[model samples]
Target: MWALDSGICNSLEQPIKRCTAKVIAFDLETDKTVKTVDLSDILKPHSRPQYLVTDYSPNGFPYVYISDAEGAIIVLDIHHNKMYRVVLPRAISAGCGESDVLYLLLVRRPKNQNMVIFSYLCGNKVYGIKSEFLRTGRGSSAIVELGSKTKHSVLLGTDGSNGVILRYRSESELYKWNTDQPYKECNFELVQLAEECRLSTHVAPGGKDALMYSLSSNVADYLNHTCGAGGASARLKYISKECEDDCY
Candidate 1:
């Protein structure tokens, strides 16, 4: 197994001769250093000064996905005890926050095909793409525009077993994709919250909990044991935001 750390050198190599932040790779088996690579050539300047590995594959192969702040991703293939960098597709936006871009390592059941799913935000629009482009580094299929352009957009998690979930400001919707067929339109359902309820959505680790926040009312609703899965039920509880001294 291998791990990656940005802005810090944990490998055996000395300091890299570059102005950009350094990315270090570590071998988890021996807990020793693996190799270090400079981000200057991979990512643009003033971009995300740090990079972290994403769990894209479940197998025992030492494949790590490292991403920068500007929505650019790199695949580090650690085979034969050597590290190689593979450039993946990147998001191009004239204006968009770094947080608006999301990358997920997804797997198709039974066949066990590994693919990277990415969503890029441009203004109020969100585009999703799933392909082997990450592996071959080119010829990625065209981007799929998601829903009507909403005022706000958030790409939640998808475990392949369930479906894809997305939140547009106050509205959350679940999309089901048939993995057996090619890319096409998906079936969707809007998750009900409350009247005129506008909020952001967050899924806890392991998709155990789904959190919905209404900043206007300083309130949050916790959906217990729900991760926006297809046809999965949810339980809602209202909680007041904790203030400096008052809990209301």
Candidate 2:
């Protein structure tokens, strides 16, 4: 498994400057750390970095993409032990202030795994770029304005295809849309967990198959009635139409 080390910055007044973040990998069978990649040197001064591991390359190279909250992404080639920084175009980063959060999601094309849809949510808008362009460290002009959602919308995950999953903060239904489809037409309801309250939902990682697993819990009862008072236990549900299969 892979995990990030945000470093020792929590107690410091100026936390960003003291962060010594790194990424670590572990062996599952033996439960031992196999590798540790220090990222302090490449990260922007005083900036904490967030990272996501991409699926193995078509050529089988392992890659890790890191963002330092700057308008750029740092691509680390784990196989070659090299790093490249790719800056986002103004079309994607323009007007986004320093306080705004940048959310990145990697969605592979169903037809071609070699092609990756790199999507980032900044403010209320989501933008897309081809991963190939990012790998080349080029400022791509092919950036696509995927769509915009209400400021209250939360990005759930991808559909193991081109569809981006999302949900309104006040709603309990999950909605999705293919990147190629019109944003206004992205009202396809993927699932509805509850009618009265919004459930906390999370899509599991590793989009290897058509079937996706989601974990959900009714947290409103826990909040309103107190911990363990009326809250529902977390449940695992399959995203396929055969919802009754292997649910727990």
TM-score of each: 0.48, 0.73
lDDT string, candidate 1, 45-65, tens digits: 544433343333345544555
TM-score of 1: 0.48
- Per-residue CA lDDT of model 2 for 1-248, tens digit only, reads 87877785543245443546788889999999998888866777645465454656667777777655566677777888888666666556556666444555677774434333343344556666666666656535646676665545556667666776666665666667666675554455566444334364566544565665666666666546654644556666765443552554
Off by over 4 Å in 1: 1-41, 49-60, 69-71, 80-110, 123-131, 139-148, 160-162, 170-186, 191-248
Q: Go through the candidates in order and give each one's C-alpha lDDT.
A: 0.42, 0.61
Which segments of candidate 2 are over 4 A away from where they belong?
Answer: 8-19, 46-48, 90-99, 110-122, 140-142, 185-187, 195-201, 205-210, 217-235, 240-247
TM-score of 2: 0.73
CA shift of 5, model 2, Å:
2.7
